[model samples]
Target: MSFRLNPFKVMRAVGIVAIVVYGVVLVTGYKKSKVTTTESVTKDMKIRNKDFYKSKDYKNNLTLPNQVVENNNEAVAKELEQTKPAETVDLQKDSDTSKQQTDSKVADKNKKKEEQVKLEMQKQAQQKLAEQKQQEKSKIAAKQAELKKQQQLEAARKEQAAAQARAEAARQQAREEENKKAREEAAKRARENAKKHQGSKKYIQVASVTTEASARGIAKKLGGNFYYKKTTVNGKTAYVVMSNMTDNPNTLKAMENQAKRAGSGYMIRSVGK
Candidate 1:
């Protein structure tokens, strides 16, 4: 077999070796740094732990008197439990006898004290009830007094109302009587005035005319004395007719009716007040 030199193979091998060497160097450096950091942290932690243990707080925590007492009691109880059974039974019987006597005496004292407390509470409750009843009596008396006063006031008001009603009735009756007297006096005066004017002269106007001939014609037709009342018509002289007849209401009404039947514009006129 002939040996051949391959440049590519050599180059490839060199590259692989370089890669492995770089990896080894990286791993070694990482391990050394990690170890140094770990050592520094451990040293600091040791120093902190030592300082803490030497502090007053650590001494106080370690010196627990209650824990030591509890341990001593536990050890003593264990030892007592390990004693001979015959001796334990005799000791237990004696202790039980003494405990029962003491319990009986304590129970008697508690019962007497409870009885006294109950009596005291009952006395206080009685006193409170009596005080409440007295207060109620006072309230009732005050209410009665108020009610009586109100009733008296109401009675007075009713009496005042009755007096006012009576006064009003009397005043109304007096006003009515005065009005009746006034009406009677007015009637008397009216009758006297009627008697005084019973003969007052009166006349009726027959008709109006422009000339004497027209006046005479109307007077002849109506059977009355005719006259002229000076008046003006279109700024010229005119005359109004008159009738010389008695002031009888019936005769005036008849004349008015006759004039109305003859013409449309005829009217009756009263003369002299």
Candidate 2:
């Protein structure tokens, strides 16, 4: 099969290659520029040294004093005297210019150093201020957290106390209701007893018989506070077995129930005290 190239893939590959080539060109150009600058500085230094060696000042220094005397001593002496002051003045001017340039450079350096020191101090002060602010923020955050925790604890305590109070109130209400019910039951019982013992005397008649001996025997068999009594029933004399009298209807009811369990008949009777 013939190889087929995708246009998009070809474009992507071309773009990548172009980028790599551009980066390489940029790096090469920077290196070349650095090398050219170094070469130019060296060439300039060589030219200056060559020119200095060729200058009149260098040639004059090389000439011997015997050669100046041989040429014309008096004329050379006069010319030297004439040029001496001018040379001295030129040297002074050069020295002063050099001093001024040095002083100017020193002042610039001092100014730059002062500016640097001021900037450093400002940076330190700003950093200290920032740190102080950060510390204060941390303290405030910690205080807020502690306050929130305390508030939550207080709320929890209050809620617990309220719950306990509610429970106690409910228990108190329950106790009050129980006491009220007990008192009402006792009053109802008292009322029933009052109704039952309306007359001067009330007794439970357990049994009636013709003879006292029979009545006494039944009272003994019945047990529990039973006695015998003589009574007229149907206009005839009869002996009756009796339970003890009580003003409490509850007690009378208990006696009746007991008698019933023993399979005996009973009647309530009022008699003279």
Every model's TM-score: 0.30, 0.35
Per-residue error for 122 in candidate 1, Å, reads 3.7
Minimal lDDT window, size 10, model 1: 84-93
Report every candidate's CA lDDT. 0.64, 0.71
Off by over 4 Å in 1: 1-124, 199-273
lDDT of 2 by residue, 1-273 (tens): 223345456456655655565555555555665666566555433234657878885688568587665667677566656652311124344445555655565557556655766676677777788989999999999999999999999999999999999999999999999999999999999988887767554567777899988888888777876789899988999998888877667877787677777663555454434
lDDT per residue as tens, model 1, 41-114: 55433244557988885687578688886886788678667653321124344445545554555456555655
> Compared to the true structure, candidate 2 yields what TM-score?
0.35
Number of clashing pairs per prediction, in order: 0, 0
User: What is the alpha-carbon lDDT of model 2 when measured against the actual structure?
Assistant: 0.71
**What CA RMSD would candidate 2 show?**
19.3
